[model samples]
Target: MSLRANLVLATCTACVLVLGAVPGTAGVAQAHAVLPKPVAYPARGQLAHQQAMDDGACYGWARQQTGVDPSRIASAPVPVIVPGGERVVGAARGAAAGAVVGAIGGDAGDGAATGAAVGAVAGGIAHRQHRRQAAALSAQMQSSNDWALSSYWQAWTACMTGRGYSVQ
Candidate 1:
């Protein structure tokens, strides 16, 4: 083999070896994206608040109906629980990691400040995504509750109508 060809082969082999080393590091980073530890039950007040709001809505609906007073309604609001702790932790962790990455990519003197700004933006984006997810889940839960409430109200109205009362 020619000297030039041997040198080319050696360079190509080195490049391949360097590239191959990158995947292991990438895999470790990917693992860090996993959700953090589960939040304890004590931090679940939001679930109770959601249930109270649902109950209030149903109570208000019953009160507005002419045939059935709020006191007579047997319907109870269902509770909804949305898990958000994981998303919050994930965003924070992602931001920290992003800051480190950005610092490495920035100019030496301004690296930390640039990294912090970039990290904050990235964190906000992640937080927004989490909020969207939480909103979607809440919507789904509310939709299900509405369906159930509609059916219950319809049945109650029918019963009132059968008893010689005009249901508006």
Candidate 2:
């Protein structure tokens, strides 16, 4: 796996383990996305048992309407680090420039070799920068997804409130 992939996986795993150890998290098992629970009360004299049934029904209705599952979330996948072509491309560019300089100095071969190495390093640095940008984009996408889940949770709360429960 790429270094970036390993770092993200390790960070996510740590978050899951830490949250799992806390009280009243989504749960220790399958704690992918933990959502906040809105406090709810039966406003129209609903029995506790009846209220539970209504809550379950509302939960289902909200999920169906929004198509966002509270129990599990399928977030967008992170970008993969593809390895290829950069070194050769950089070397080719470097060699062309180096040959021109070296022909004037009477040492084209040595100049070309030096230029290729420098160009390869520069290309690698640029590639690393791109990988960082991709990781940032992945994070932004996940944040947007979290907003969607919050909306789904709100929908569930709305459903519960509509069914004679005071949800806050």
Candidate 3:
């Protein structure tokens, strides 16, 4: 496989690993944007406390009506591959291939060392590029997700408003 593709795969593998290591990462297992906090009419004091209760009620009602769980809305940050562990794998694979190719030439050991160094450098560069692309794609996805979430939030807010709670 091409170094770039390998790096990309390795990076994705690492992302999955890191995400797996995180505790409580099993909720919903899907990406979504966050809902805007509602602007309660009563800002503070006893009425405000009551408003909090109302807000909670409205949130539950909204969730029931809209099927959008606000708690699980925001998704985890996308993983970007840093140039690390992947370099070792790349170097090893390259050396093995290079050594075979070099055996046909003359000096297998020299060829293997040179190939390994080149492979490691190439892998690092590829990993960096992959990370950049992943970051860009992630940002784009987040934008789209945010838009979708806003639409859902709007529906939820409207439902709450219809139930007689001030929602913005």
Candidate 4:
């Protein structure tokens, strides 16, 4: 095979691999969250009603003061584990390349099949490593976001406490 043919084969293989690896966003499921129950305040009669009103007002005020969206409190983001697409693409490409090389030995089909299997395993390993790195970064980002959220929660709780409602 000419150098041009080899380059074309390599290019096509790479294109297939890259395109296959891209993730699709359609049909993603939304996560459901269980919100914390409201704290019960001790009060009686007319005082109980007043306390209820206070709790309602204070909760709203705290949310606004802390700039925390209620929806965010309801639903936290979940990280997704991506499936590898590179394995199939790699195997296909490897087989094509192998066959071309094996043509000189008059056993192109056997060489292609063997090459494909090896390429697939290598691709799977590469995919695993990529996912590991992505998961680590995702965890770090989640930790940072959790800290910020906790800071907001603390501030909100403080505001409610200052409003004369015993906050737990």
Candidate 5:
């Protein structure tokens, strides 16, 4: 597969792995497959069996229209909080680099101190930026998930209603 395909596949796999399935549910997809349960009545006096058939047809259409498989929504990945060590690592690296420079000029200790401080500040800034990005990504994903679900249910409801069911 191409790089983009590989990345997409990997990300989806990660989502399933990290989030797992919702609890107290049976089977694989069932664990997370929570479709909107709008109370629907057969207004056109359709038979119970016919209602079931319409329900199945509408469900398929809804999935096709929205591309939001309820089965996969629950597996949406939450970003893992990686343990922070950027500042310390940055400080150490900066000190080492600074020490070399300082030794060429005069005092290694003073150079190391200046380097460490500068490195720590830079690292701290980088860390903050990372956190912000993670937060933004998480919010965006949630918004997307919400939209997908709403859109799917709306489509599904519309389908059922069109098929002579009084869908709520």
Candidate 6:
């Protein structure tokens, strides 16, 4: 197939796989519904048992419109490594330094072997250190992203539910 076709197919396949893998749970189900178009919400005082009633109405409406269980929709957590450029740069720097150190130790004849061994060990250590640092940074970034996304999604979902719209 053409490159474009292959890319499209790959993307579609990935999306399908992701959707299929999502856990089936009440919160997830409620998050995936088609948000009502031109969302309408009752006037402030018109809502009785406001939160619960609104959630139920939205869930039922979404079910009727989509023929899918509202309880099965789920919100996926956003991944944290989206901004890993800096970590990549740091890894590249470490690799260059390791290579230089290796070359410096190499000498003519036996010197070359000695230098090579030293360089290999140095490079390996540098690479490991770089990876460990990057991993730690990535973890921190992921945690922050998770917190922010979770908070935003929660608010968004609550609003949609209040508007009698199923959200996922």
lDDT (C-alpha, whole model) for all candidates = 0.41, 0.63, 0.58, 0.60, 0.66, 0.42
lDDT of 3 by residue, 6-108 (tens): 5644654464345332223322222434556666454233365666676677777777766766566564544333333445556667777777776787756
Candidate 1: stretches off by over 4 Å = 1-109
Model 2 TM-score, 2 decimals = 0.51
lDDT of 5 by residue, 79-116 (tens): 44442555566666777887888788786766666666
Candidate number with the higher TM-score (1 or 6): 1
Comparing 2 and 6 on TM-score, the stronger one: 2
Cα deviation in Å at residue 154, candidate 3? 1.7
Q: Positional deviation of 52 in candidate 4, in angstroms?
A: 4.9
What TM-score quantifies how close candidate 1 is to the native fold?
Answer: 0.39
User: Candidate 2: worst 10 consecutive residues by lDDT?
Assistant: 21-30
Candidate 3 global TM-score: 0.55
All candidates in order of lDDT, best leading: 5, 2, 4, 3, 6, 1
For candidate 6, the lDDT comes to 0.42
Model 3, residue 137: distance off in Å is: 6.0
On the 0 to 100 scale, the lDDT of residue 22 in model 1 is 23
Model 6 CA deviation exceeding 4 Å by range: 1-108, 165-168
lDDT of 4: 0.60
Q: Which window of 10 residues has the lowest lDDT sum in candidate 3?
A: 21-30
Query: For residues 1-168, could you state the per-residue lDDT of candidate 6 as single tens digits?
Result: 345434543443353344232222101111122223233355454454665566556556655544545223234422222221222233334445544554575523233333333434444454446446656765664565444445444554565655655444
Return the TM-score for each candidate structure: 0.39, 0.51, 0.55, 0.62, 0.63, 0.36
How well does candidate 5 score on lDDT at residue 79? Answer: 47
Each candidate: how many clashes?
0, 0, 0, 0, 0, 12
- Stretches of candidate 2 off by over 4 Å are 1-85, 161-168
Model 5 residue pairs with clashes: none
**Which of the numbered candidates is closest to the native, going by highest lDDT?**
5
Worst 10 residues of 5 by lDDT: 21-30
